[model samples]
Target: MPRYDFRCRECGSTFEVSRTMNAASDPARCPDGHDDTVKLLSTVAVGGRGAAPASGGGCCGGGCCGG
Candidate 1:
């Protein structure tokens, strides 16, 4: 299950719901029993190891130089 963030316009409260991707667009009710809600754009965080930093600085500290 994926968590989705929603904001209730009636009470101006934010809440989260866990549901399947198929039902991601479904309307969510707030904890205060408010039916008027809108899904909020969520940010995805990626974890795990990425490319190691360049050893020596060449251009832009070798970070963007792909050294």
Candidate 2:
């Protein structure tokens, strides 16, 4: 079972859950017994587009090969 992140809307508590993919369709309530928990997206998504270069400066000592 893969783990997914969830956040409790009532208390703003983040948690991890392990269950089958189908379980994500109807998630369980928070341990506090409130049905205000919502699944959070992957960290990669929060970082936004990631196709950018690794470094702003060239890697080959500015030799123009990478500069």
Candidate 3:
């Protein structure tokens, strides 16, 4: 089961929901009778501290003595 984000135009409400793929395929309409409701493109990311650090260069903090 994957959570999805939906945007409601009738009430301008953007909310998240956890449901099955079937339910996710067919999203429910806005309770306020707004047909403009649509699924928003989003990705579920995990920002955690841990694992291995980057061996390459990144922004200001990269290789030795970046000026």
Highest lDDT among the candidates is held by which one?
A: 1
Cα deviation at 30, candidate 3, in Å, is 1.6
Q: What is the number of backbone collisions in each predicted candidate, taken in the order shown?
A: 0, 0, 0
How are the candidates ranked when ordered by lDDT, highest leading? 1, 2, 3
Each prediction's TM-score versus the true structure: 0.70, 0.56, 0.53
lDDT of 2 by residue, 1-67 (tens): 8788888999888888888888875675787777888998886544447665555566554567642
C-alpha lDDT of candidate 3 relative to the true structure:
0.76
Which one wins by lDDT: 1 or 2? Answer: 1
Give model 1's clash tally.
0
Query: Candidate 2 — which residues are off by over 4 angstroms?
Result: 44-67
- What TM-score does structure 1 among the candidates reach? 0.70
Q: Which sections of candidate 3 miss by over 4 Å? A: 46-52, 58-67
RMSD of 1: 4.5
Model 1 per-residue lDDT tens digits across residues 1-67: 8999999999999999999999999999999998999999988776557856457767766667772
The 10-residue segment of model 2 with minimum total lDDT is 44-53
Q: Which pairs of residues have clashing backbones in candidate 2?
A: none
